[model samples]
Target chain A: MREARDAMTKYGRKAHAITALVREAEVHRDVYVDPEIFELEMEHLFPNSWVYVGHASQLSKPGDFITANIGRQPVLASRHTDGSIHVFYNRCPHKGVKIASEPCGNTGKFFRCPYHAWSFKTDGSLLAIPLKKGYEGTGFGDTQANGGLSKVKNVVIYRDFIFARLNDNGVSFEDYFGESLSTIDNMADRSPEGKLAVMATPIRYMHTCNWKMLVENQTDTCHPMVAHESSAGTAVKVWKREQGDSTETPMAVQLYGPFMSPYEFYEQSGIRIWPNGHGHTGVANSIHSNYSDVTGYLDQMVAAYGETRAHEILGEVRHNTVYFPNIMVKGAVQILRNFIPIAVDKTLVESWVYRLVGAPDKLYERALMYNRFINAPTSIVGHDDMEMYERAQEGLKSNGNQWVNLRRLYESNEEQDVTAVINGTSERQMRNQFHAWAKFMTMDMDKHAEAAE
Target chain B: MITEKTITDLIYREADLLDTMQWQAWLDLFHPEARYWMPLEWQQQDPVLQPSLMYEDLLLLKVRVERLTGERTFSQKPKSRCHHLLQAPQIVACDTAAGVFKARTSYIYTETRGDMLERYSGWASHDFVEVGDALKIKLKRVDLVNFDAPFGNIQLFM
Candidate 1:
């Protein structure tokens, strides 16, 4: 297998060759289609990057835990007795069986592996082993090296959103995200109490396409007007027919109509590209800006923060903020989408809606409505996007086009400070993502350390 | 007096309308204030408090049907089709004079588009009311057996 992988030049799968697949204006299609490249991503990209685990609200109580995957590794994030969040590998050191089998539950005082009675505390320290006498002469020990759950190297909980990285040598969270952390801050700040609680269950939708396609689509503002014409466009026609000569538009129309917004509107909204493949659309306004005012919601925001601060929070309207690789957060709408790669050709997307604490019920209801209308498995608007993704997955198999174009507005872009601003329809986000992809894919630990030294 | 047979017939007719892609007819069967709800969790109480798989009023349902029938809707270019295999509906509550009728049915619904076909087994509970001699759907709550499982695009009404 190593020889076959080492000899890979068909799609440029070698170390030096991987960077060649991504260029300034275009990317080789194999990056999205090749299983070997996907394996490399699981190895190099996902582990080295901070992946979202769960919201702190999920582990609000002691012993509360959620099981998630940081790339290919199954991990458990739990609230310890000390009130700190801890992430550990889900594997039981005894028989290598998964300690926590369910997605989420309380671990009580400690996690007792169902396979064996070997137990570990919420902090992942070895607590008690039932058959300790048998291992007295053996080499087994109670420490992490022998029996306890292995803790993940790095875990960061920024403003209640939890993230874990498998490797300690990778870039720190602050260095990796930088200004893009504001997207999370913005979402949390919408609450009068300055906190966001995730709804209990997420709407999980499986996509028959590569995970990158979903990430790219979040920032691909150009496609909505064209791809959603069937769903969002028809919504306009229906509203017109339903309210002939009437000036009033319904809430349903308000939700679905913006996907058919003209190109000029999106272009004027603008896009902000941050470093490390992170970016968001709607510098001035977005589809979320037009939502009708929720009763009493503004009053709560005003009471929480003074008028000026509240205005600053509400005024900063942004659309899908791609956190690079796996997650996208829409601060304007309180929606977070985590894209979990299942296979080379399959991805599972979990869409979570957060409730702005101390806000009116109507606001959270609207968020839920938006989740149903746009991200649910039964979403009419989401189906069109899914269709396009599936089509792209199937079409990329052809040898006719070796490269996928990301040339739109690549040449001329204005950069100031650590961020760049481009037209909303520009493909700069895609190019930025590919740049990060190549960097992560080709990174050498030895070289990185030498450079740091 | 609305008999059990009449209630079962109405339930069957609703399923048939969906299965045959008679969206307009299906829409007509709904009361003006009708709500279609598919709860996310088992025995989920409040659709407003918790997120639901689907919870839509008549207006939203109309928009979905409109989109389904639209020419430009590319997802429907290869229009999705469905078949409902329903068990005999049991008339849970029948109050003829007061104009309140309720029925429960077990259904296996299959939706297909292109080469992908998904099968879902669920229980459909219907709340009905008489609107000028016609029974109309006030609420249709569907509880899928695998409601918590990860799913693909469910393109049609179930």
Candidate 2:
């Protein structure tokens, strides 16, 4: 188990030993702290899996582009003149400078490298070169092989949510996401027009911990009552003091009340885990279940999808659907959070709120309020969680414990199944995420195509 | 007439309340329908449609104050502390008929907890209403210079 970790061991063999860090119900601290393991994850895990890049709405107009990262590699997505979206390495082929320096903007007719001004079409094909006559005899050419932005291997737009995979070595998009794509679909279906538009900018928060901690915390339903007691618990006390006699719960209380919900509330909500590190923690109920109705929003949804379908869509309440390795979405609330790992101990979390097109503006306001209340840098609830993550990062350095436990409800986990249904507080989702992590990090790239199937 | 000194004094008092962690006393400075806004974008127009970093009415502000003072709030165990260094405030507008006045102050704020400290420079724009010789905050908008940068936990009000 330890042989492959030897300093002199070959790179390929070293990854095989990484699986040793993860066990049935325990994960070694090195998995979260080791620089070498972090490098391996960037190389093997991020490139092979379909990581979300941007929403199609962001690139609705031709020549519009946005810059993002796949692991450590900087990439950009742009809508071409032909109306097709393309994801490419943001690097200019000449002298390797970034083509787009801004967070997002329209590239006009084409992207021009700030250094030396080598231009490329929105499709990432090299269009023009400065002083072309000088390069006639040289190896430089207009073709992509000579000078062009390299394209990512795969790009999938499922219900206007754009996802890109850096390498072509792993599972097909369909095989990887499977039924988990429904979360995106569910979000779009909430809009009366069956469309969702992302706010132009996302509110980004930095976490001084491994990115996986945020992903795991999404489905870890037990923490809210305990960890958020200060924020939510205080809200409960204040509500009882101010509005105890009132029959109608105010919107603020309705939003903050669920954080103090008993463990049984989550258990009854149910947790479902799907293949490839995808899962959500709600079926019958969630924190989103009790939100006050926005007047006429339901009627618009009913007009779009008939009464029964509308009710079905509205009734589908999910709290945080983790799309393996990077993205998490709250379908019921129309918010998406992407976790970008900055280093072994630092991660950037971006929260984006979406507008349900055709729904009442009041509903969108509620979503915006929720984002500010829970995810903002100044958020009362978010600060507590940030403290916990930072503490975990510091505590992992202690020699007293080499393993972090995930044994809650482990005895009943349906280990052999592709999908598992269990109580909301189960650690099965974390286990599922780690299993997928091991598969992506350790398995041979050649075998991934078949392994996913 | 609301003199510049009178408005500046009131603004300074507000900052003093915040710096001393007088959570309840600071809460009393705001009118019933006051809004505390920290816009996420440059020249952000619609707080309802666009997402702001901090947008809270009096109720939300009360919740924040309660949480900050809560016994179980682990994040505040170390007690994040902040200091406001403000440039001389300028009274931008005075509408005597409406009993409303606007003041803008450029400030450099620093927050520290344990070993970590963060410095933020911004303009705090305040809308004040005179009520019975007392000025109450109708709105306090903070516009940080790096409003778009990814930020760590802003544990307390800026």
Candidate 3:
């Protein structure tokens, strides 16, 4: 596989261009606009790391499948007849066609390729191929490593969260996400059943900028007050009208009006950036901010785990956890947003809200309302951010500014290796991502060579 | 008998109110329980199970109207001007005794905001209720032609 060395050099050369500036807390616009760098990111970065595929609850039954993508590679998660979840490359080995084309559906016993008559099991092993009598002497009849469909190499499921890698020999999922699993744990532990159900329909929307723009914006505490002031301010006026001169601020105001918070507020909010490019904020704000506990729900939780444990579980208020390359978990709202890269200038973002099992009905309803009012494509808040993303992509095309700034808190917070609890307003999260970005993009090609041998 | 022309004329009045940016006047035309829905999926019957582009009741619509007319709604900074062109609506179903009817109308919504001009064309299904010689909107559901294929900045109603 390594005999033809031309493409590897191109990948190396394209990646080197971004690697030079990313170390200095600065990245050139070419990384966001260049086609070669996009391909290199797919080849070098995504395949070597654990990219989130789908949640286990998405594949509810045997033969149920949900399709996803890792970088440019199409993948699907399917439940086997034996009741285990597996991730595969989603292609027939013979014709290289997509086995299941829909976003999700049941394969009903086995997968039959629509183009050809090739058939495979739910786990992607070959079941049947037509006209076998003609190829007795030919090696085409032989069932190789992949019988009919090519199986994905590495799949790791951590408590219903499924992740897969297209290639091998890299950081495992557990090591890649060190202490960040606690965030996931805190989210799942909210349920008395100690799990979550994918309750809402997933929303897929296209962004007109590079995927990293959305990633960086996840923890960007500074841009909100400036970029979203228009929408948030409008929401506040409307809320005040509803209150009819009452001085009491509504919880709905905090829900939509937090975008008007100044830099000083975010600075005191306590942002924590973890290793492996995981970071989060909004811990200062609780989901249980304004409401008294619902009847019987708290007692049910207490009955399940006693009082202290229930309080601990309900007290977790994580805002956003961006897991390196693609996954962003908004724990407070129980929503997961994944960014899939299509090209250098385009991205597809899919978000799904999870319902904590055995939790209060109002709790799930609040999350649903938040999803509809904030994340939906036509949402008032999303209208602001989407416009900014499109404008940012358009502005980056200009040569006026070659380097995008990540210099916020750059000098004082120079300790790159250690996880630090910086101010919420710091750009440390963006820098932290680029730190992992540099690592993944410039991972030693010698490792690939070693694997080839 | 309530003719199709009567329903078509009523719809045209509603469109005129929207195009003229008379949102409050248009809001008054609907019943208190009227639902304005634009589904994300084609023929999505229930708004509870499926996500929607716009699913605003009277109170929610009032809040949105306030925002749209506010000073700092940046998405509306340049202001959106709408022009709705519709074919003659057909009365699909009717119950004369119950004062209820359903009309199917197709429209082209041309909107100009800032320097960009975008158009949204769709089939609109309206469930109307006649009350004391006046027709009030009970439910207005819009099924966009590009309901699946997405576009940018869906500002005005179709």
State in Å the error of residue A161, model 2. 0.9
Off by over 4 Å in 1: A1-13, A142-147, A244-248, A412-418, A445-453
Residue pairs with colliding backbones in model 2 are none
Compose the digit string of candidate 1's lDDT tens values, residues A1-453: 844544543432355568789878799998899998888888888887889999999898999999998777899998999998999988998788898888888989999988778899999888888877888867676444464789996988999999887877877899889999998999999999999997678898989899999999998888988899877887787778777677767777888889888989999899998887888988879988988888888888898898999999999889889998789998888999999998999999999999998888888888888888899888887898999998999999999988999998877543422588879888888888888888766664344433343
The segments of candidate 3 whose C-alpha lies over 4 angstroms from its true place after superposition are A1-15, A141-146, A245-254, A286-288, A291-295, A444-453, B1-4, B69-71, B77-83, B92-101, B108-121, B129-133, B145-151
Ranking by DockQ: 2, 1, 3
Ranking by TM-score: 1, 2, 3
Candidate 3, DockQ score (0 to 1) = 0.45
Error of 2 at B65 (Å): 1.4
Evaluated at residue A282, the lDDT of candidate 1 is 88
lDDT of 1: 0.86
Taking the candidates in order, what DockQ does each have?
0.78, 0.82, 0.45
**Candidate 3 per-residue lDDT over residues A1-453, each given as its tens digit:** 444553454444334555675756778777788777787789888987789988888888999999989998998889999998888887778767888888788989999888877888898888887786665777765656236567777898887888887777788777788888878888888788988888545766777789999899988988777777666766766676666768756444656776677788778776788887888886675323444455687788899999999888777777788888888987767888888899998888877888888887766766766776777666777877887887788898899888898888777538764677877878888988888887887674554553444
- Native contacts conserved, per model: 0.76, 0.85, 0.34
Score residue B99 of candidate 3 by CA lDDT: 76
lDDT of 1 at A407: 91
Off by over 4 Å in 2: A1-13, A142-147, A244-247, A445-453
